[model samples]
Target: MARVYSIVSGKGGTGKTSSAINLAAALNSLGEDVIVVDANISTPNVGIHLGAPIVPVTLNHVLTNRAEVTEAIYKHESGLKILPSSLSTQDLGRIKHENLVQVVKQLKRLSKYIILDSAAGLGKETEASILASDEVIIVTQPEMPAVTDALKAVKLCEQLGKPVKGFILTRHRWKKSEMQVENILDMLEIPAVGLIPEDKNMQKALMLKSPIVNSYPKSKASKAYFETARRLLGIKEEKGFFERIFGS
Candidate 1:
């Protein structure tokens, strides 16, 4: 059975969607079959991030009994399959959040990893995604407000009995103003799985409508994402000799 990880955040602009896309890409690069689903039905962006802003079928169709989950699956040039939600506003009301668990169950048979890019904040859609996931990875910024909100998300996951796969910190600048890794982990009561640094190349990758890992593998962000993927798969990452000599 595939492991379903719902990439969630307590608030928007925390790079939850970006983390989901890049992590899926990184896993695929490691020879794993991965499918990313846009479970954020109301404000979906997985399709947009993958360069397929529109598709004939989507999660919305699957939930409403209009289409099979397989029909919404689209393969990106990078080899990662995505089940994106419809971009039309009209489809929002038609989605039955209760069907999400069944949809996820169907997807588990298709890939090694099923990444659900859940909506930010505590809402009906987010709740549905959380309940369906086998585990969750909370994405947050290295700041107070974001971390606070992430704590709320962590508590909710606890209440639902979902295993939190730990926190993935994004847009990290490594500046003094940002929250320290140790403190963030302690406060959230979750271990640090990955720390993605702020890289200018991310903007270029976004403009080109491709994952940073695929577009700029040499960039810091891509390297961090790859490391994150390795950690998730229980693969040990070896540091370069130069880094070992200079201290990472």
Candidate 2:
């Protein structure tokens, strides 16, 4: 069965876009057909993160009725398909946020997994993404500020009647100041689907305009992402060395 997942965050800089890209790549590598859509129409990042900063056809065009949803999808070199939004500021005013669900529906017929990278904050695009998804995964850091916003995101999901699967803790360093995984799960009342470490290779992957899973497959962060993918697919596996250390 096809499932559409929206990767949302309470605020920016929580690694939401990176999560969407890498998660999609991970699933594709595991023999699933996946498409990562940049539903963050306001401040799009998936295209930039994937190194295709600009494309002729974009989600903006699909939203504005200037193009079909099928026209906007571009397959990454790694065989992962992506539907990126236009980076132009001019398209913002003309966007039809209400049409996103329709585009997502169109995407569903084309792939098994549709990963929607939503805009940060509870904005119009964010709500549209949530409505378009079958399930949502919130991404946040290990700090209070990020976790607080993540909690807010959880409440917003409840208010909207959207089912939130779990939260992905990103850039976790296990520092004394950072919130622990158990406490975060307690506060948010959700499962920990992913616990990404603070690895420098993620930045290097960004610089290379490739997913960490593809650019640095042997890196700690890459392994975590692949593990997260397996968890999402409900594949049972033993604790990885990182999972043992992180204690998730």
Candidate 3:
């Protein structure tokens, strides 16, 4: 069955877009057809993240009926498909948030998985994406402000009648200064997709305009994202440390 997942965050800088990109890339590497949509129509970043900050046709065009969804779809070198939004401020005023549902319907016919990188906040754009998705994935960091915002997001999902697949705790470093993992899990009271460890290679991948899954496939963040995808698909995990760490 095909599934659409909206990677949402209550606040910005929670690594929401990064989680969406890496998870989609990981799912693609595992032989699934995945399309990542930059649902942050106001301040989109998927294009910027992947180095093509500008494109001929974008999600903005699709929303405005200027272009079909298929026309706006761009192929990444990693074989993952990306549907990015316009960077132009002119396009923002023209976008109709409700049209996303229909656009997503069109995408469902083309791919097994659709990952919507939602706007980093509780905005109408994020709500539209969440409403159009089959499941919602909350992204947050190991901090009170982020977690509190994530709780609000969880409640929002509950109110909006969206099923939260789980939460992704990103940039986690097991330190005395950071919130303990146990406390976070207890506070959120939701299933955990996985924890992404802090990895310096993430910055390198950003510099290379590529996802860590492709740029540093062996890195901790990449591996964690892969594991997270496996969990999403209900794939039984390999128990061996060597296999989990270095499997083909």
lDDT of 1 by residue, 214-244 (tens): 9999999999999889889988667752134
Candidate 3 per-residue lDDT, tens place, 69-185, comes to 999999999999999998998968878999999999999999999999999779789899999999999999999999999999999999999999988989989899998777887
Displacement of the residue 244 alpha carbon in candidate 2, Å: 7.2
Show where candidate 2 strays beyond 4 Å: 240-248
- Which stretch of 10 consecutive residues in model 3 shows the poorest summed lDDT? 239-248
Cα-based lDDT at residue 119, candidate 2: 94
On residues 88-116, what C-alpha lDDT tens digit does candidate 2 reach at each position? 99979988898999888888899999999
Question: How accurate locally, in lDDT, is each candidate?
Answer: 0.90, 0.91, 0.91
- Provide TM-scores for the models: 0.95, 0.96, 0.95
Pairs with steric clashes in candidate 1: none
Q: How far is candidate 2 from the true structure (C-alpha RMSD, Å)?
A: 1.7
